[model samples]
Target: MADLALQFGGDLAIGPTGDLLLSEGTTLTQQRVLRRLLTNPLDYIWQLNYGAGLGKYVGQPGAPAAIAGMARTQILLEAAVVASPAPIVGVMAQTDGTVNLSLSYTDAAAGETSALTFSL
Candidate 1:
């Protein structure tokens, strides 16, 4: 099933036809991955453990390795990602306190590799 498309900041996307955009295939998988990483674990009532809660790292002492490890673990939990070739997660903490994250993974359903990058 296709999911309602979402912009980078989690806003609903609109299509050219004056309707809501829908996402599938690699795009959908990527969206799901980002949602999982960004959502707070306790915020989702049904599944308390569903998220990586990456926001918790913001404005705090940076631990790139630990953050990367947490991201990697969470990415693997995503059903769309392939298990054999684990996802690659890279985290960089800047002097200004912004943390950048990069991820590379194989999309199981699409049988293709994908990459995503974002900041916290």
Candidate 2:
């Protein structure tokens, strides 16, 4: 079975005269998973207790504890999702107090290994 989903956060009206953007094929599925993993639990409509976004680590000093907390959340989120096999998640606190999140996963359907990085 082919898994598919509308790209998450496709609300931007950047088309010619403002049309909602869309993603198809494996890209759509990948975007959905990334959005879900990055979203804050209750921030999205009807999404309660569902996200790996910042968590309590936000606003706290970017210490080891803070980074570890965020990493734990990221790992949990990846495990909860079904798009990819177990992912390798890395979290690091930058000098400017931001966090660098790196995620690596093997796309079974596409038969490719992919890695993504985000600064939060």
Candidate 3:
């Protein structure tokens, strides 16, 4: 059996003409970890391990709050993708009343490093 290919947006490749777009190799792996982190678990019937539901972590943006949320976020990501190293998570409070989630992790299998930033 071959591994399935999926887009970061969770769209399996379907050509415009309704044909399956078969992605391969590095193209299939790029951003895969990040996408998994962005996905919320149980959002889909077929994929129960899809995401960490990071949106739920949105909360008051203070040093203590950020640290606590960051810890939870790291645990969620770790559970979601065991092959990836425990993520380095950082939080920044914004003047606009938003919190920034900054994350970086290395894929254990590919040795690829990824960085992502999200505002909540």
What's the TM-score of every candidate structure? 0.92, 0.61, 0.50
lDDT of each: 0.88, 0.58, 0.55
Q: What is candidate 2's lDDT per residue for 8-74, written digit by digit as tens? A: 4544434455555455544654665577656777887785866656545645765446555554455
**Span of 10 residues, lowest total lDDT, candidate 2:** 1-10
What is the C-alpha lDDT profile of model 3 across 44-106, one tens digit per residue? 578786566655655644553645454446444442233445666777766766667666655
* Clash pairs, model 1 backbone: none
User: For candidate 1, what's the RMSD?
Assistant: 1.4
Instruction: Indicate the TM-score of model 2.
Output: 0.61
Best by TM-score: 1
What lDDT score goes with residue 8 in model 3?
Answer: 62
Highest lDDT against the true fold, candidate: 1
* Model 1 alpha-carbon drift over 4 Å, by segment: none
Write down the TM-score for model 1.
Answer: 0.92
lDDT score, candidate 2, position 8: 49
Lowest summed-lDDT stretch of 10 residues in model 3? 75-84
* Regions of model 2 farther than 4 Å from truth: 1-19, 59-85
Question: Judged by lDDT against the true structure, how good is candidate 2?
Answer: 0.58
Worst 10 residues of 1 by lDDT: 57-66
